[model samples]
Target: MTFVEELREHAELAGAPLPQLSDGRDRYGPVAAILFAQRSFASVRRRSNGTTLVTVWDHRGELAAWGQAPAVDDVVNTLRAWQDGVPLPELCSAVARYLQAGDPAAAIETLWSVLTDDGEPHLHAIVAAASADPTLRALRPWVSHGTLHLLHATDAVHGVRRGLAFHPTDEDAFKVHVYDGPIGPVQDVASAAATAAATAATW
Candidate 1:
């Protein structure tokens, strides 16, 4: 069966509502179900000027909801296509949002899996944005310090990791190894230090 069909079957088993063109119709529930069944879905809310607010999910049900709804289908469809291409990091990111909205613990777990899977650096980016639990922060040590450090730096550039730390406080106390990239550092230590400090303070 096609992915959409498989998703429909699962939605039926899960008793989720499906998607519909209009909200007033009884079939709307099924349409909602279909949208919810997959890790990603969009809610079209009509507004002034025939626009909509499209809420996209990241696994946790915590939607990175966006406005300007009428054009959302194109965005959502593009994302779905990316998932078919070996699990884009953004898919995991969306799923992370979904989990965070509903169950933070599950979101963290899902984010962790997404990170370790295929060693996708993008997972680090997603986890940085989606999770803020202290326990999850503790797990960062297991990640290569160099990689984490680099991510910490890049996170600064993108403002991704809001409240996480590169290393535990007492810099001298942590015996962490740094991973050197083949090229000259794309990120400077000062920037990374500032980013790490910010993360430590917020999350």
Candidate 2:
């Protein structure tokens, strides 16, 4: 099967639907792109040597950018290498430090990545809070969609399930709304990493 065909079938089977973009024809061949995360575009190009490469484009277009457009460092990486077994959105904002040219901490050029900008200060504060408090020491704090989550510090992927979820509140600067699970309150019995105190116990 062709690279794009296999990719499309696999993505569909995995339940993460990949939407098609413009059928751009570049020097390589007939270029095809998939728009999974907003503004994030990755192309599949099969080289003459039978190697398929995925080029992730970081563009500034009002919509998804063409596969042949200029990128941050114009680095070409294989889909598996670039994805690294993570979701597509990770690639959207993960294009930093390519060749060490741009600021590693600079925000990505996309609306989806920008949505989490409001919680930057809270993210820093939570890190400091977690560093001093031994209870939070074992749990790594992460922010998603402007909400703070504490996950087990297994590895760079924030391995283990997200333990405590904190939502910033307008009531006070230092205050937040803590939830139990990923998107809702923790379960009554099977709610924690160890047991109730880790899960069911209220913050």
Candidate 3:
């Protein structure tokens, strides 16, 4: 079956029925629905080129992007990679550094491996939170907040705790947050990284 057809069929099976595209081009929403069906803590996004990306969080709680092509075979392959816990390409891993440095284009290209090199930490780490808690697994599409976040509910008082956070303020600037505690170390790191990168860029 074609990639679009397979997505439609799979989405039906999962009872998430996706909307039909008027021009029949592959869109992020439907693709996301298929990948996220019955599964949470992961998101699928549409690239400018119309390719679909499957996103998860790495061990460090950074966005780990995968699933570039979105062809029927590619979608199936990416899903299998996730299910089997395969590592992302080595080049894909560079996105974390790119993001930390406040480079969205570089990060996106890195995740897509546009230039090709190798990607992310173990895919398992990205999915672990959901795997351990059904409540988490039901969170769907994970709020983008401009960048991807790996979140889990810690305690009732604490609410949702994010391991990593990416905030895109604009095309020219963005922020990356990484932490040890619920929110302390991350705020400091994010502030420092943004200031440092911005300072360096001015020179």
Leading candidate by TM-score: 3
- Which candidate gets the maximum lDDT versus the true structure? 2
Q: Which candidate do you rate higher for lDDT, 1 or 2?
A: 2
- Alpha-carbon lDDT of model 2: 0.38
> Each prediction's Cα lDDT score?
0.35, 0.38, 0.37
Q: Give the candidates in order of lDDT, highest first.
A: 2, 3, 1
Total clashing residue pairs per candidate? 31, 1, 9
**Poorest 10 consecutive residues by lDDT, candidate 1:** 24-33
Stretches of model 1 off by over 4 angstroms after superposition: 1-101, 119-194
Candidate 1 residue-wise lDDT, 36-124, digit = tens? 33444443333345443333444533333332323434334433433344243454355322212334344334334434432334334
Q: Name the better of 2 and 3 by lDDT.
A: 2
Model 3, span 77-140: residue lDDT tens: 4444443455455223422211122343334333333211211222222233222333323222
Candidate 1 structure, TM-score to reference: 0.24
